[model samples]
Target: MRTALDVHISEVGPRDGLQSVKATMPTADKCRWIDALAAAGLREIEVGSFVPAKLLPQMADVAAVVRHALTLTVSHPGLRVMALVPNRRGAWAALTAGVHKLTLPVSASEAHSLANVRKTSAQMVEELRSVVALRNEVAPGVPVEVGLSTAFGCTLQGAVAEDDVIRLALACVEAGVDEVGLSDTTGMAHPAQVRRLFTRLRAELGSHAGAAHMHNTRGLGLANCLAAFDAGVRSFDSSLGGLGGCPYAPGASGNVVTEDLVFMFEAMGVSTGIDLQQLFAAREPLKAGLPGEPVYGMTPEAGLPRGWRA
Candidate 1:
């Protein structure tokens, strides 16, 4: 299948990727990695989270990391600096840091939401109401993104109903989200499921939604990404060297590999505007950031094959 579409890949290595690993990337090194990725032409990058330092030591300096990322001069110039906020407090911290975008992780699976974040679906939406209220009051210009995690299935619960995910997505948007996106938190998403859910998501949210965040834990990340793109999703959430996963979910692989997703799109005659070579060039600083961290990705390990072009 072929279509004329442009895809924007967002790197989540600094936040999602780093948080998965036990070792913390030095604050400075993390900025360098983010800079390298930006140089590679990635438009949006989720720098880190605004969660408590004691709970997530790796992200103890997330605010500092986001500030550093915002300082970089990327190709887009006004890069999208994204951070995850677990609650209203985190949302306040993220806004104070001047982040370009703030995303909240709202699990669609009821059981997963309660177990992972200790908040039921309704409670999470309520938190969004407060986060949205704060953003409207202090930074009305800043956009809030609700990443509907476990939209396809859950680790604790077997299968996540598509209806349930869609309902929560609608609720989040109604609560005051500028946009909404779906995440395959457990990597149980199939390409068909990706297409179906994202198609429904767009139908519900209209022109107010974005990318698909897929995990490679089950090796379907890239395939699922293609499905979402086919379903009208342009932006995507990926991590450098595939170095991320939910700290709570064990089998979920890191975000889909950035290089791999970019390669797939670029190879299929789709323009991502991201240079494959420069994208891989980012690996050095990424490795330098968190030494001993196991960065995952097929493109990084195999290197771009002969005659590849972006």
Candidate 2:
């Protein structure tokens, strides 16, 4: 359990980061990267998504990656492996592979929901119910987390209604999901909106409210994360080197950079259980995994503030 002063950074680079890029990371390299991330003290990681190989070749080897991540848990007892699932089938496959948690993305915007998953928000809630039921039968101990993407806004639709987001979140919770997370999928979220929505979510879902998945598209990723933290959100999802973007939303930037976010928290005297130097060192395996791919991070480029200590 994390205290109020303790912030949990869930690394989504391997899963969310790789999916956006064209090149497919070798299965062995993916495992090495994940191991490096764990060694750097990232206790929770989204290793991969269980989508079809035909639809996303980048995640075709997700099962193999999950097996490797499970093995890492043997050495790193505090490590928690998480995978993304699109539906009940994916959820079953992820559970069989022994992930500690499964995150199902439910779009708050109806247009984005249809475009991304070919289902409406209401239909996604029904799917969540079925997925939860399947989890109860197969892996009763495994948790299911629903990420309400486009909760702030969507590209397909101009503005997503806050009422709609709240209602959909309530519906997902009623459908028996263990937790509900908010995602700025299109990178249109502002700090004030992040704080407001998170406060409302916590009020309605209580402890079941999950992580904040913010994007750096508009350069407010860190600011929005701080707003969410102020509103009682302890868990945050970010990518190493800022390597992720939504395929459904055109022109959206990658997720918030993990190294920068860690620096922000550690500088503010918040403990993330992650070492700055080791965390930056983990970027080596990531670069090796995806040769020629561009990775972004202010902390890595600026070499940490002068005379700074973590």
Candidate 3:
């Protein structure tokens, strides 16, 4: 991965990682975690999702969290402050909250889409149209990213066809999303499959296709990420302490672990630019914030494999 791959790792721990656990962290604790990560050299972080509290109790403080993170993001214009929105309403709220990037999930598996968002794949595409329209109307330059979850496979639908993933990815781009992210929501992806699908999507959608959101469920999380990097994906999403796993999503953990990922890239000389020590420090606040929740990651627990750079 060091030779030619120069991927940018975006930590999703605060947003995706925390939302999976059963406990909730105070908004101030969330801000402190974000700052710790940023000071550690992380260029981007997804602060939280703007979903209804009734749906996900973990993300109930998303609005306030985003507001707090906004203050810090101003100091580093290169740093991205992003949030996840489930629908048009969430997107609108995120835009008003002053987030730099907004991502929406669109499942390629129709059955999974209905189960997750209560809408068919087609209906979700239509909803994205309105999201894009709203972004253009209010924040014209703001980036709108569609994280197409379950792009590889779904627990509900069993297997998601490659053709379906490609089709929905193209549709998301056509629907006006700035970038379409491929996610292994259930962690059923293989390196070869990731290489193939990413290649096809890149050839078709060009610049609109990017990012890889993988899970550690199958233990191929980092391997799949390297495969995506090999296939030309620059943006990779991960979470600190691997905090999140959808309650309704069976066997699906949150995105990849941030500590392990940064260790993999920076150790391999790929230049993630994130300090492992500071990243580990960020997790302390997360642990304190969400007490009683089990956080995941091996590198943090192992201490960066003996004699590593700070």
- Can you write out model 1's per-residue Cα lDDT over 40-158, one digit (the tens) per residue? 88778889999888889998988788778877844457578989999999999999999988999899988888877899999999999999999999999998988898998988888
Cα lDDT of model 1 overall? Answer: 0.86
TM-score, candidate 2, is 0.98
Among residues 3 or more apart in sequence or in different chains, the pairs in candidate 2 whose N, CA or C atoms overlap within 3 Å are 244-254
User: Which residue pairs in candidate 1 collide?
Assistant: 17-243, 241-296, 244-254
lDDT of 2: 0.93
Model 2, range 189-256, lDDT digits (tens) per residue?
99999999999999999988999999999999999999999999999999999999888887778999
Ranking by TM-score: 2, 1, 3
The RMSD (Cα, Å) of candidate 1 is 2.6
Superposition error at 265 for model 3 (Å): 1.1
lDDT of each: 0.86, 0.93, 0.84
Runs in model 2 lying further than 4 Å from the true structure: 1-5
Clashes within 3 Å, all models in order: 3, 1, 4
RMSD of each: 2.6, 1.1, 2.4
Residues 1-310, candidate 3: write the lDDT tens digits: 1223377888888887777776777888888888898888777789989988898787888888878777875675577788989889999999998899998889888877887889998999999999999999999988988888888888888888888888888888889999998988898898999999888888888989878999888889999999988888888988888766665568887668888888888877888777788888888888788787777889988776666655
Best by TM-score: 2
TM, every model:
0.95, 0.98, 0.95
